[model samples]
Target: MTGRENRRGRSRCREPQQSNHDVCVVPEEVSAHEGKPLYVLVALWCLKRGGWVNRGQIADAFGISERSATFQLTYLSRKKEQICCELRKVKRAGVPVESYEVRVTEVSPEAGVRKVSEKQREAVKTIQRGRVGNADGDVRELTRNIWNSLQRGRKA
Candidate 1:
């Protein structure tokens, strides 16, 4: 029997070879963020791939809707300086699409950290200051307060 064949005479399926670039090194901070884990992960994925990642690719990789992926990409593009990525809008097969290219393979300690404005900080404080009582009414009031605070912040 040939070395390539197993005892049953069927050829073994070989695993696809991977280059050094296929190895993705995720930083602690990327996964540490309570929020925006998908955004950070998509950035790292783009960096590891070293190419333009479209919304469909992001959606496939993260198991999210294409719109959600686009939103994350848009957010990253807006914060390109903080995230170290580049965004390009191009037409694929005559359909306009957005793609992201990560500028760095390695993430810095401060990467992806957004600077909170004082107004946003005050809003957070106001939400946190609400008392959490055992009563259902108290919980509803707290929820309403948080929702109102968010709406006010959005309007400002």
Candidate 2:
């Protein structure tokens, strides 16, 4: 079987030919964050495809649910300044689909600095202040305190 054909002999989704210029440069902030790696993968996939990609296409390519694909696309849309893409609502075959136009050729490290709100900053500060030590007892205490605060409807 050829690379274009699956085991069942069905042709795979046509991806654009990759050239040297077709590169997805992930920024340090994206690489360092948890759960963002999937975002990076989706970005890279869209970049290589070089056109409007629908949620179903993303889901099939990544082996994820359509809802999860939508979430990834939505998150990427919010990072448009860093990823150099835009989200569009378009109809394909009379079905409305959420699509992303991947126009990113390269990304600089400086573009990855996400704007954090004052509330987010304060939350980070609170977590940092709560970290007394790396010992097992300290870690357990911190977790318990966070759980308790969450149960009490307070910010952890």
How high is the CA lDDT of each candidate model? 0.57, 0.58
Which of the numbered candidates is closest to the native, going by highest lDDT?
2
Which pairs clash in model 2? Answer: none
Q: How does candidate 1 fare on TM-score?
A: 0.45
Q: Give candidate 1's error at residue 28 in angstroms.
A: 14
- Candidate 1 lDDT, 24-111, residue by residue in tens: 2223323333243446666766676777778777765554667777787886676555577666656558657544433434434566
Candidate 2's TM-score: 0.44
**Candidate 2 overall Cα lDDT vs. reference?**
0.58
Per-model TM against the reference = 0.45, 0.44
Checking candidate 1 for backbone clashes, the offending pairs are: none
| Root-mean-square deviation of every model | 15.7, 13.6
lDDT of 2 by residue, 1-156 (tens): 113433444323223233422212232223333233456657766777777787877777654677777787886777756677766666558657435433435443435356799999999877756556667987788899998988889643
